[model samples]
Target: MRAGDTAPILAVPLLLLAALPAMGFADWLTLSASGLAMGMLLFLMASGLTLIFGLMDVLNFTHGAFVGFGAFIAASVWARLPGLVAAPGLAANLLALAAAGGAAALVCGGLGLAFERVVIRRVYGAHLRQILITVGAMIVAEQMSVVIWGPDALTLAKPASLASSFIVAGGAVEKFRLVAAALGLAAFAALRLVLARTRIGLVVRAGVEDREMVEALGYRVRRLFVFVFAVGTALAGLGGAMWAVYAGTVTAGLGGELTVLLFTVVVIGGLGSVSGSFLGALLVGLITNYVGFLAPKLALLANVALMAGVLLWRPRGLLPLVRT
Candidate 1:
């Protein structure tokens, strides 16, 4: 499938333009920023799956487990460092945020390594088994989280610097959301850069083309796969941590609840394409907010409708990396 089309790129601006007439300029501004922020968070969650799917070709149902793990882990970090998290100073707030995100990523990545070694390595080519086993693992992980964190939802407060919204052109944008968007954008850029301009990316792509040939070239494909899986899970965890901050609460089922949306993004963006996931996320986010505003009753079905429409128009998605 072609991956260079610019048509899909216009979806965001077009949607923004279409929504302008329905609300005031200020409202539109606020909603636009909100949608962009939402899209970024979704991107963070889905991007890892794209990488795993593209290179390793594994259907990892346990991806969501990492998200819940990250959120809970970050919550624990905040609880342990109450002073840094609650401080009004930016430096203190950043330190706390970094610690939480870093810890979540590390823990989730470690879990991914163990999971891949114990379970995933055995079911490399079996899609059905991958789905079933990973789903089972996800359930087990969720239950374990409940056992460790307790069954009650845990409240998470943003650092003082990010707890409030700032007004720009009469529109209010939460500081946390802005930071989340920036983080997501940076991740996207970095992933693109690494994949397109690095030797590791070259080897990965070469492996995707011919595993035996790459192995003949003395590259350890299996080790690379493990690394990719770990990175994917780590990204999911980081995304989950950011999401927890945004939602202000953490629950064991938080990740499971978002599974459908995450898959929708993966499918809509074209499985295995990071760029596609980014665009798909933005599309989902914008459509959701717009539909929520215009027809409150249809909010639940907005994503499905959008997915259906996109599929009808482009069966392979906007920028599929591989033929589906």
Candidate 2:
């Protein structure tokens, strides 16, 4: 990695160190673990947006709608499969959860394809049009969800096996958080492998760097863009499913509320950069948690403050893509 590449990475430890002086060791440990888990979840959701922006250069304000819809879909799945989710066996609970996540991904992936074809295609290269149209689409999606789900907040219970906490170094860490962290790591590793080692990954990266060149090389760039959008939406769906369970409730506005945070993460991570998104997420998560604990009144301003600081230091974001 280049010297410039180390800035974002070192930021994580720096934030942690800064927090340590303000809290007790045990409190810090617990909060840090929770922060990391939250960050991982955010990364899972934001990574797709970054990829979509990086490769397709489309500002998909409707992305959060996918998340809100996915949460509802997964909630429905859990409601229908009570026997599986309520089973005492961990395997049964896990299987049921996996099924719900898969269902969300499949449904949202299909929706993303349709969204790209019908809504996004017309607004290509027009940032203002894209923003207005996609925001409108998001509002419509939220209303559609309210119509289908009755505008009531749906509750999602974690599996019995994952509802408790484990003690580590005298600090209590929630099992669900651990699961979330693990899943986030897996997603990151999988994305890295695919983007670094596979042919499709090569084409995607090439398209991101130079779309005209990739098209000139005989690859169908439009089709590839559609697929990337699908994948990005699928990831959003998956993250929404996980988040619904974490928050223990779902509402049509859930995605709308997250939209701000998601954009903050994408910008701080650097537009179109996954690794930057991951690091940016961690920083946001840590800062929020630390601030919430140290000064409850400023908790809400934590992310805004962090974003301002990062932008001041790196205007393009922590890990901006290099364009020739």
Candidate 3:
């Protein structure tokens, strides 16, 4: 989609206004920021899946397991580095968080490589088999996590510096939420720059459109695919670490619970479009937060309703990529 497209962008303001009837300006601001933060975190978790699906046409049900794994890894790291996280200075706290996030990403990226080699390689190009095998893989991964971490939820406290909120005009805006939104924006920008300006990104995009042709051009498409998968998995892991801090707890089933929502964002955004994913995530986040506050009973159904409404309007999603 071109920059001129405004339909998706317009949805944000409309949704914000729709919530005005239920609360005052301060409440609205708080909810809006919260919703945007939630959306960004979702985008982080879902973006990689969208890329993998768009380029490799892989139905990776086990993607959620990576999220859970990343959260647990980061939590373990934090547990071991309590002093750094609870330090008085922001730099120390941030450093601890970065360390945990880096560790999670590295672990998940390596795991993704192994997953592609062992489980995913056998069923390439077969959607049904891909789904089945990946789902099975997810179940196995979840069970293994339980055995390793115990079947209980783990607490993940934000660094002391990030645990507080600041007043933004009269509304309290969380420090971590703002940080998450910034990180999400940074990730989006970096991804776009890589795709638009880098040689590897060019090869990846070309491969997405026509793998055979890219291979015919003498590029190592297979290695590129593996690299893309690893990157995607790492993104998911990083998102999970952020989410763990956001939620204050991490469980083995964290990824499973979010699978439906992640897929909804991906589908609404279009299979492979990063911008679409960001827009869709924002919509879902706003709808969820607003409805949850205004009409708690309908909160759970908000995303489903939003998805149906969007698909009914645009069957291919808001900004579906035109496959070459």
Which is the leading candidate under lDDT?
Answer: 2
**The 10-residue segment with the lowest total lDDT in model 1:** 315-324
| TM-score, every prediction | 0.95, 0.97, 0.96
Order the candidate numbers by lDDT, best to worst: 2, 3, 1
**Candidate 1, residue 232: lDDT:** 89
Whole-model lDDT values for every prediction? 0.87, 0.89, 0.88
lDDT of 3 by residue, 1-324 (tens): 577678877877888887878898888889999999999989988889988988888989888999989899889998999999888788998898898889989999999999999988899899999999989988898999899989999997778898889898788899989988998889988988898899998887787778888999999988888998999999999998888888989998988888888899999998888888999998888888888888999998999999999999889887887786
**lDDT (tens digit, per residue) of candidate 2 on 150-202:** 87899987888888888877777898898888888899889888988999988
Off by over 4 Å in 3: none
* Model 3 TM-score (2 dp): 0.96
Decide which is better by TM-score, 1 or 2: 2
* lDDT of predicted model 1: 0.87
* Model 2, runs deviating above 4 Å: 1-3
Global CA lDDT computed for model 2: 0.89
